[model samples]
Target: MADRQLRTVLEGGGFFEGPRWHEGTWWVSDFYRHTVSRVAPDGAETVVVEVEQQPSGLGWLPDGSLVVVSMKDHRVLRHADGSVSTYADVTEHCGGHLNDLIVDAQGHVFVGDFGFDLMGGGAAATASLKRIGPDGSVSVAAEELQFPNGAVITPDGGTLVVGETLGNRYTAFDLGADGSLTNRRVWAALGPEVTGTTVDEVLGQLVVAPDGCTLDAEGRIWAADAVGGRVVRVAEGGQIVDEVAAPAGLGVYACMLGGDDGRTLLMCCAPDFYEHNRAPVREAVLVATEVDVPHAGRP
Candidate 1:
């Protein structure tokens, strides 16, 4: 178990999310900056691609090229050998803006949508979990999800788990060979879902706004509690087994279990998440803390 002590890995970011540790570096997306960047072990950052429509989730293809979620346009963009292009267009199939995504070993991508106009102020609505195959074809993997965000696939490739932010729980699905998701069930339920427009009202009802998360070698989940300013490691049954809180004025928007040995838990800290507030500032930072469990599973 770790405490609240966290050290800065990188700073001056504009609302970071979708962190992935791959190929000896940390890749993440800056929502406001509209860029996907990679941070080295020594905290150096290099912009991989500048997405015009805004970038959220990040993954890679089988050919080692980068794939990013274009949030506002509801598209997935691929960057290969220094060129960016559309990999899939999911606008007609999606209700709202697209969020985070996970790419399996076979290059199958599972992505989530917002379901409502979150930034512009809309009522809570159900969303869809979409899957994009290697051939650039799209399909609805699942539906009626309440704000599906971060997602991860088990190392054995048998299961896929996603964080439903508004639902206060993580949902699991059986991943079939044909890219179909089945056997949907609640993997962890921190609290019941709450519907509200104001921040206080929504926060009051949520036990934990489970945001971006990563899986550890022990089969546990390290989920960022967006409203609680803490990153909690939850066991299979939704029990809070371990946690690490951020300092005042900082909230953990996303997290990844990564490092040379995968024992480092990287926290994406930001001052706030509101579009009006966070879009104008560069107060976000990348912080790291040592953990006992190393990482396991897909991006």
Candidate 2:
């Protein structure tokens, strides 16, 4: 596939992640800014809420309430009618900081965690995926995951695909009728998983570190390669069919297939991401490229 041209849609962000198109608008979170915002088609940005801890993922509940992931505190905050409250707190269940999340049509929120002290330069450890039900019940959805970063649910809500950033693959699970995750398998192995490798060696050997992803109508996943500096569209069995290379000196962190027609591939780009380097200076941006397939799936 030919490399598509990426155009900056919104700029001057501390670090953007979890891009989603909902209710005819694009929603995202800036980590350092501790805010969730909505971006208009014309590139205008409106802050939906200011989170004190930090926000990563954005989703909506059944009654039109906004559900956001508070990263540092490991809480899901629900905003309804201009009011904010804790939907669920998973601090005790999560191994480290929370990363990203997706809410199903039935109001089941699947959240990921860091599993280890990433910013503190700790060793890589297995993580787990947690699910929060509508009634504020929390449980471990799946266990021993290698740094699950982003996830998406099929339109029918039958399957959940998650990007395992450290595992170098996209893992999948069958969503049962009772909200249980079973039949865990690798949906796509973008690269080999290096076991017993140091964190630096593992990072250096990754061909494509699948960070965040969105699904298209044809069942293809457009995933941002966190270390590869590109957003790749992968078909079944880890085959990369298309891609949009990031600009020089930038790393692609997250991506979503959205826009008026749903063909715009939105990518989050930053100079670098670390606890110390990323500040409120707004070096990150949301860039987009047009594709042939339209988006189809739940955030």
Candidate 3:
């Protein structure tokens, strides 16, 4: 299922979001250009840290330092040797801003938020996923969830999946060797159970809004149907099998699966998911293609 033919590994961003290929290159997060760059697989770019309470997801910490996800001050900065600080504040357990995170392999992060006030329209509550620890401390590793953005951590780390952008679904848990998340379930549901509550009545019963995700090597899950511009690949129970779409007028939201044999899948396009038209536009982009499993967990 490798629908290859979509290159363009970087562009005038302003929206992009937590991608991550690590050590080799690709890390990302731009939300209105508050920076956190690093691309280079021929596209050259490099900025790596400017945050200003904007950068989303991104991980690393097992002494390699990097952390990020300062999404509007809910904190989690770290960056080591180069200096950035605030390794975990959780702003008293967020309820609106912070979004997206994942960092297991003993560093254990797992963040998420946007339980309400989504871009200021308000009314769509329920969110929680916290976990920080590794000496930074912060807890509440799972709760109602509903907008928990993106997350992953498996490769023997004992599962953690997560993507519930407004709750079209992805869920899953049970990782506790100290990170604690416990059984929980529903690792794929892309369609029912939205039950509206504003935000245009739960985005008019979204059919597949599960934004930002990864995890391949057959365990499936590519997800990023953020409004269905497309990415889907899910396979744990709500079977979608494969999908990609999102090149005309763009709108992919997020995706990863890195390169150098990980079967690259990147993608993060834009043109929608408004924060006032992507915070005053630079248009956003970071595409790639080629897929057939090869990336397995944690990011």
Off by over 4 Å in 3: 1-19, 24-56, 59-65, 69-73, 79-94, 101-112, 117-164, 167-195, 198-204, 213-222, 225-255, 265-299
What are the models' TM-scores? 0.96, 0.97, 0.32
Measured with C-alpha atoms, the lDDT of residue 174 in candidate 3 is 84
Poorest lDDT segment (10 consecutive residues) of candidate 1:
194-203
User: What is the per-residue lDDT of model 1 for residues 60-159, given as tens digits with 9 covering 90 to 100?
Assistant: 8889988899999999999998899999999987777899999888889999998888887776677999999999999989998878999888999889
C-alpha root-mean-square deviation, each candidate: 1.4, 1.1, 18.1
Worst lDDT run of 10 residues, candidate 2, spans: 193-202
Ranking by TM-score: 2, 1, 3
lDDT of 2 by residue, 1-299 (tens): 78578788999999998899987878999999988999997789999899989899888888889999898899999998898999999998887789899888888889999988888778878889999998889999999998898888888999999988888899999997667899999999988775853578678778888888899999989999988898999887999998888988999999998888999888999987785788747789998889999999977
Per-residue lDDT tens digits for candidate 3, residues 147-167, read: 888877788999898988877
Each prediction's Cα lDDT score?
A: 0.89, 0.88, 0.85
> Which predicted model would earn the best TM-score?
2
User: What lDDT is reached at residue 195 by model 3?
Assistant: 75
Candidate 3: worst-modelled 10 consecutive residues by lDDT: 1-10
